[model samples]
Each structure stands twice: as C-alpha cells, then as structure tokens.
Target: MYVPNHLKWRILLAQELKQAYFERENSLRNCKRIFELYGRYLLGTTYDTFLTYLNQRKYRIDNLRMPPYIVAAIGLLEPLRIASERLRLRKMGSPWTLQEIVEEVLTILRERSSTPLDRRIGQAQQHVE
Candidate 1:
C-alpha cells in the first residue's frame, strides 16, 4: 500500500519515543510523563508545527499509521540511540534528513515488488540453482 512520507516520519517518531521511555519504565504514567517531557525533542518539531505540516500536506494526523518509511527510520535510529546523549551534549547533524528519508522510503517501496511474473522469475532461477 502507498503511504505518505510524513506519516512514516510520525510513526518512526512514535516508535522511538516508546522505546526511549516506556521500554524501561513499563508504566502508562511514566510513559505519559516521559512523552510530555521529551516529546518535543523526539518529534523534531512542536505540536503546532506538526499539525500545520500535516495540514499543508493534506494528511490527517489523527489516523497516522506506521508506514515502511517509518519502519526504515526506526531501523536507522536504533543504532543512533547510543549517541543520543552525545548529540544532546553537542550540536550534531539531523537524525533523518528530509531528502535522505524520502529517498530511502521511495527506494524501499520500489524494491518491494510483488508481481507474479517477478516471483516466477525468482522461482525459475532458484530451480536452475
């Protein structure tokens, strides 16, 4: 299914926030408190900005679902979490550049071919091997 890039970013951000906060505390209260405390940093923008961006893109923020782009972003961010502290301590690069993220998401979608012909070709090749 086709998914918007912004939705992907939102999903990745949500996953990262969950991992960073709720994974350790494992409490809804703690999760909520942590979300309130660090949500701005995790989201990379203010709530108003987020809403505005979504609105500009004609995307509904209320029903955002996790897209493949977001899944890829989460994969990328997993390793970076180790350096998150250092990042906070010093000025650093953006975690996910707009161009890079979009490119990655597109690449992922392009690579996700599921055509019967493609599968047949793959099966034929497997038989040959």
Candidate 2:
C-alpha cells in the first residue's frame, strides 16, 4: 500500500509523541517513589527556602525600622506629656508672674549665700590673702 508523504510524516510524528509520553511516564514512576518516601522533607526545605527569599526581599524593600507614623508619634508624645506636667505643676502652685518667680529665685540664692559654710569660706579666703 502506497501511503502519501504527508500521511507518513503524520504517523512518524504520532509515534514519536507516544514514545516521549511513555518515557516521561516511566521517569515519573521513580519520582513518585522518591516523593512518597521524602515528601515531608522536600516540602519543608522548599517552604524554608521560600521564606528566606521573602525575608531578604522584605528587608531590601524596607529595612526593619519603625514606621514613620510611629516615629512621629513618639517624637510628639513625650514633649506633650512634659508640657502637660509643667502646666499641672504651675496650676498647683501660687500663681506667680515671671518677675515674681525671678525675685523668689534670687531671694533663695541670697539666703544660701548667707549660710555659715559660705561665711567660713569667705573668712578662709581673707586669711589666705
């Protein structure tokens, strides 16, 4: 029987494809056994490798510093608390103007200067001279 050239080519191609399929199927039979024995280990290795890759990429994208908003809040929050404490302390005391506060501080300093230890120091200086 004389087959056409195109038919012969088609038949050859079909046989080649069928043979490749069987070879691939036979190769996968070994893989099937290997996977059945070491499936959990292989999966764990793959998962760990993928997790490491993701962490590397994440650090590259944003090195593990605090977010900008959190930093801003920390910067603002402490000063606000300090100011609130200062206001509360001011309210708790007698209401004194700036000049009164200066006068009070000067009086306290003067009283300290008149202590016996200061007078003794002054007398020691005169004797040394």
Candidate 3:
C-alpha cells in the first residue's frame, strides 16, 4: 500500500504537530481540524512535494517562517478541494451495499494510519504532474 501523495504531507505534518504540541488525547481530539485545515487542503496538489511550502519548512529552509496569510490561505482553499473530490468520486460509481461503504471507510482510515503497508505497484504519481 503505497501511501497516496496527498496524504504524505498530512502524515508528516501530523507527526510534527504531535511532536511539538500535542499529547495523545489532544492529538486525537484535534485530528479533524488538522485535516480540514491542512491535509484536505493539500489533496490533489503537488505543493506538498516541495519542502519549502510546508508550514515549518522542515528541510528546505532554516529560520525562515511561513507567513500567517499563507497558512490561512490553505484553510481557505480546502473546501474547493473537498467539493471537487466529491464530484469526481460520484462520477466513478455508487456503493450499492452498506458493506461496501463500511469497507471503504475502513480502508481510508487504515491508509491514514502510520502502519506500514505494501508499496503501491508503480512509481508515485503526483496530481500536478
């Protein structure tokens, strides 16, 4: 299970936030907000591949800080990303059974977890690329 590209940054950012600011319960509590503000905003965008663009700019830069407005912009951008994904998936097909829907949700949650998974069969494909 190769992790999806959109999720990579989310994972990395979550790791950072947990390390810096959150303990277990707080981390779980804020999970949804974190995803809404950061993860989903980044879906389908190659922006996350560029280290300099992440909130803390972990590897690409030192001491320089991301602007507050840029962070706010990410939150602002998430709804469009979510809406378009909804449309795209709707066009694909419908889940005819409750089992299918439950399975899909479980699969998504698993993918988002830190458990090691089999790498996807092909080279990573970036949405922007």
Cα lDDT, all candidates: 0.53, 0.42, 0.43
TM for every model, in the order presented, reads 0.29, 0.22, 0.25
In model 3, where is the ten-residue run with the lowest total lDDT?
Answer: 120-129
Candidate 3's C-alpha runs over 4 A off are 1-29, 32-65, 93-129
Ranking of models by lDDT: 1, 3, 2
Which segments of model 2 are wrong by more than 4 Å? 1-62, 93-129
Q: lDDT: which candidate is best? A: 1
Best by TM-score: 1
For model 1, how does the per-residue alpha-carbon lDDT over 69-126 read when each residue is reduced to its tens digit? Answer: 7555655453344344444455355574556545554555455444577797986577
Regions of model 1 farther than 4 Å from truth: 1-16, 19-21, 28-38, 44-64, 84-129
- Model 1 has a clash total of 0
Clashing pairs in 3: 1-118, 2-120
> lDDT tens digits, residues 1-129, model 2?
654543333333222222322223354463343333332242333433323432332223232344466444433433444444555586676564666554555555566567899788986677556
Of models 1 and 2, which has the larger TM-score?
1
Residues 50-108 of candidate 3: C-alpha lDDT, one tens digit per residue: 22234443343333344566544443343434544554586576434545544555555
Backbone clashes under 3 angstroms, per model: 0, 0, 2
